[model samples]
Target: MSLRKQLNDILPTLLPNNPAEAIKGTELIRLARINLTGNYSDASLRYHFSIMSCDPTSAIAKVEKGQGYYRRSEPLPALSGAQELLAWTQGRLDDISGDDSSVDSAMLRIRKFRAVVTRYYEVNGRFPFAFRDPFTNTSPLGNLWKYPELVLVDWETGGSPDEEMSLDGGMLSLKQRLGIAPFRLHSARLRLSPSLMTYREDFFQTLSVSMWAQGGELIYAGPIADEALADGLRKLSAAYGVGVTSFGMTPEVLDDLPRPANILNAHPKETEAIMAKLDIHKIAAAQSRPHLDWVALNSLRSESEEADKLVAWLNHCIDERRAEPFKDE
Candidate 1:
């Protein structure tokens, strides 16, 4: 008799019930393991099988199988694509200072990693178990893949009205196409004028600064009061009862500081007076201090009244930890 026929007949005796279905399932798994192209060793196959079986007890077994696969595939050459990707990611993590350029590059690298993995999946029809941290041998996909790209665009000078509108629409469409939920970080710029100072209070009160600090980009307009900005943020955190180590402006704080207060400057004398009151050196120092949490915002500003209302509602939702419509006046 053929091997399949013999297995179908004999598996019934070995397994208790529904031997026919079990046999078919096993055959399908076997086919999947052998037919798929990208790097499925025997150990990987066994791991895949355990996962497919859906037995709770098989978790440990799968880990053991994974470990075996790693052992067998050890000593990946220094120049391999996987090794290079890991090295780049590690380097970024190690040397990432509070510089905007550095942060931007790191984010780009993350996106590149995602693109690589996604391409592999598309071509191979499965995720490679071997694609993991070289040191921990653990997959970062679970922790990082789901996190949306936190892009910070300056609202002013980012684009023309038509271009900005197109980009806003594009972002929404991209999220839908990728099956990712809408961005958690609202893309609203926080203006620092006296009139908007009240909004800052509402911001601190309405959103979980801790949660936002954990992820997302914070873009801001140029000419910010770096030191005052940091102090204000720190005070807000304290007022809200959130324990934060530090809060400060980005490296661009110096470049973006309100043009130095001078008679020749174009800014109005009153505006320059306000700018002169800001201690640039002190702000820079506060921002440069170690152990301080850096807060950034995207530079993109929403001009629409509707967008402003959405941001307000989003703030409310963030505070409540639910996305329900805003009911409170």
Candidate 2:
């Protein structure tokens, strides 16, 4: 077999998924030698590593800040194909002009945008719960109308979500007596770009999914540069109370970012550096409701395992009277 093909088959198994755990070139070459067809010089293998890491199709990836390589995550197959991608892009309403070659590239961009948003919210004190099953390959397109990509939880006491913090006794009691939720939940729909034509669908989808929550937020990867788009979004938000915010990460910027795992697990300094690239704009603020829609939530929990997990996580935290980041056991 050709060396490139051999590396492709072997690298994914040997490499770590996270950049922090990336293996050095020399070590990786030694590991690859075990499965390689013929004796290859270290220099040749290193050169191949350097070249293949640049290819998005290749399984190997170099660390953004250091000297090592890791596995590049495969694109999710849920919404593959250029036609499906352009349907969601923020360029134009009728702009499904791209060819079929952009499926993997577009899917990777979507994954990166999601990771950045998740990390952004996590660091900013809101615990984010992602809805995955609804976007799986086997799921229906109508799921977009019913499920949000993310739901953000903001605790009332302003405690560290990284560790368990005691809920305030008096404040908790007061809210309980007043028949109000101790925390505010906001459902969010995430998109790669913002377009003048498709902003309403985005707004309403956010509103629709958040019907059971306190509020809804429509978050975009790119900035809201077009005034008309911003105006339209603001008007919708005013009428419906859905929040809109832009992270200012264009497709090019998202492409330049590290893998999802690296971004989520970056050091404090690295995280700050990654965050520095964002030019966040809150186009319209969300209106919060006092309590959750139990009827809607009860119905949703029956449809989505993620919903049940979300509720279980929240219940566990409340039962313990402590706030901590959600973790799957």
Candidate 3:
């Protein structure tokens, strides 16, 4: 059986009837981990979201706070593919931080570890690994199927012991370096429930500050080139009670600020020069010609719209979790 099939089969059994909330929670962990590496290409991170989906549930979930760190009980079926993803992400992180030695060491260690266990499983029909007392190997597949287990599991099955190491001098560090505060990036998904509606304003406020601090701009929902979308953004801003202020961006400022396009669009070179010339003040001042063309984009972005949708999807997962039935303690 393929790994994806195995994952789908096993994961469902771990939850209480509803599988959607579990899936959402899993993706959240995956996203935060991958993004920490800073290896996502223009659209690499987007692929993670594209592959995500969930079902609705009417059961309400009992909230648990900081329930110890989650650890997968079984090895991922697409272990090889996952390794490649890690490599790609780590490579980008290495490049950004100017640390080749650490990257090389980490990759080599992972390769050696994988090779040792995979060989054992193929030759002996079971993993040759063992864990500390009171712990035993299990499949991450969650007993949803009767397939024979091939991999050993403990705390390590889910990720490396140093999964948090990726944060050192990486994306998370960047945020800390900027002293950027965290806030809720509100989503339409949360608006679906009265319980979550309270977070709406707080969410947007958080996102706005985070984006600005990260050298990102607030690009609300809009069409790539639709005038209607632009007008819609103006209305949405007022309706949502979000604020927009004018600013300046000389070529230097534009070059330094991280544009959402650079992270989402497949082709950014064409817009790089133009985007750098966009001065916020000029656009707000109703400047004509070249300046206006660039200014229009700064006020809104296609990527922001995409990010907002992803946030909404995540919010839905939260709602789904809250609605799930729980067992008595």
Cα lDDT of model 2 by residue, 180-229, tens digit: 87888999888776655456777887888899999999888876554345
Model 1 residue runs over 4 Å out of place are: 1-158, 161-167, 179-208, 212-273, 280-329
lDDT by residue (1-329, candidate 3, tens digit) is 44334334433333342222333444534544442533434344333222322111111121222211121222111111112212221122222345766544443433333332233222332222211111112222221111111112111111334441122224333544665321122111001001111223322432332231211112211011112222333454454443322222222332343333332232446345533433222101111111112232233234234333333433342433221111112
lDDT of 3 at 177: 64
What's the best-to-worst order under lDDT? Answer: 2, 1, 3
Which stretches in model 3 have alpha-carbon errors above 4 Å? 1-225, 244-276, 279-329
Error of 1 at 237 (Å): 15
Better of 2 and 3 by TM-score: 2
Off by over 4 Å in 2: 1-101, 158-164
Candidate 1 residue lDDT tens string, 21-42: 2323345445544435455455
Q: Model 3: how far is 93 from its true place, Å?
A: 11
lDDT of 1: 0.29
**Whole-model lDDT per candidate:** 0.29, 0.76, 0.26
| Reference-based lDDT, residue 189, model 2 | 87
TM-score of each: 0.18, 0.69, 0.15
